[model samples]
Target chain A: SAVISQKPSRDICQRGTSLTIQCQVDSQVTMMFWYRQQPGQSLTLIATANQGSEATYESGFVIDKFPISRPNLTFSTLTVSNMSPEDSSIYLCSVSQRADPTGELFFGEGSRLTVL
Target chain B: QQQVKQSPQSLIVQKGGISIINCAYENTAFDYFPWYQQFPGKGPALLIAIRPDVSEKKEGRFTISFNKSAKQFSLHIMDSQPGDSATYFCAAAPSGGYNKLIFGAGTRLAVHP
Candidate 1:
């Protein structure tokens, strides 16, 4: 298992404000992903943040609304832009140590956000 | 479109009983199936996983039964304990790609002592 840490475990922000959640892993990894869990919903892949490429957004997610940064193998950040009440959810960061074909994900303690 | 569907949105079990959660997927391209356990306010942790080649895989008290033809898989927890009470999620990933997982709705399990 990998040790993952996220900043500001929980936060409350007003509508139209943006919040950035940071994730750090003890070991270096190739693929870092950001997922969002809406209230009472399952986790949804927001984007895939690779070391040296643009993050790939999922179907319903866009980079403009949910931008992701993978500065290095061990660190990544997810920014929720132009937030609204519906944007309030738990943001999780996960990493895969092995190659893409066969790898398991290890997640961090999610960042819980509450929008007013 | 929901890729993976989970059943019994929630479950209750007695200590020492077996707790079972089932999930089904639509895409045959998904070859890897993994189950995750999550406590309140915490990120999901990988419990166990299986590939299409195997019918079943077990790790300690946790077991995953996969059915290739049926496109379904299930998790069975033997001797369920109070400590095992949490939300369980079943996810599937494509065989080759970035390995993005499509998660199930999740099942909240409660074990009575």
Candidate 2:
């Protein structure tokens, strides 16, 4: 089991501004993932933040828009750059422990961003 | 290309009745299946999980039934209560790699007292 905390639980930002959401894990995790949940939608994979090197982004997502940084095993940050009204959604951080074959993800409280 | 597909965008069940949500996946490589429950303003929490090697796994009122051949799985909430009213999401992950998850659209369940 792992505990995760996300900062700026809810934020209201103006369009064209950027917001960085931080995720802190209680224990060292092998993988950290960033996800986006639009209004009344499912979770969409934004990227996989590795301890080193660049993140692995899914289709339709790029590093320019969602820049991820995994400085260590227990912390990661995701920046939603050049935000728009369309970017108004909940940003979630999830982590998976090492040697966990089930790949169960423990998530943070999530950062709810409202773009006006 | 939604890797994971969930059914019944919303469900309403009476108290003491059973609430079931179904999900299917197209990726044969996916071996780990997990269901998450979310309240109105909280993050999704893992309710139950099952691997392809097993047919079913249950924890208290939450049960996960897996059908590897059909590439499908379902979550059964027995003896539902009003507190069970929330959104449920079914997610799938490949065996290895970075363990990135692909999520379904989610099912909103309302258990009336």
A1-116, model 1: which lDDT tens digit per residue? 68999998999999999999999999988778899999888999898897777898889898899888888889999999999999989999988888654677889989999999
Report the lDDT tens digits of candidate 2 across residue range B1-113. Answer: 44799999999999999999999999887878889999987889988888899999999999999999999999999999999999999988877642567889999999988
Note the chain A TM-score of all models in turn. Answer: 0.96, 0.96
In model 2 chain B, the worst 10-residue window by lDDT is: B93-102
**Would you estimate the TM-scores of all the predictions?**
0.96, 0.93
Deviation in angstroms for A91 in model 2? 0.2
In candidate 1, list every pair of residues with a backbone clash.
none
- For model 2, which pairs clash? none
**Cα lDDT for residue B10, candidate 1:** 98
What fnat does each of the candidate structures reach?
Answer: 0.73, 0.65
Global fold similarity of model 1 (TM-score): 0.96
Model 2 docking category: medium
lDDT of 2 by residue, A1-116 (tens): 89999998999999999999999999999888998999899999898898889998999999999999999999999999999999999999989897653456788889999999
Error of 2 at B7 (Å): 1.3
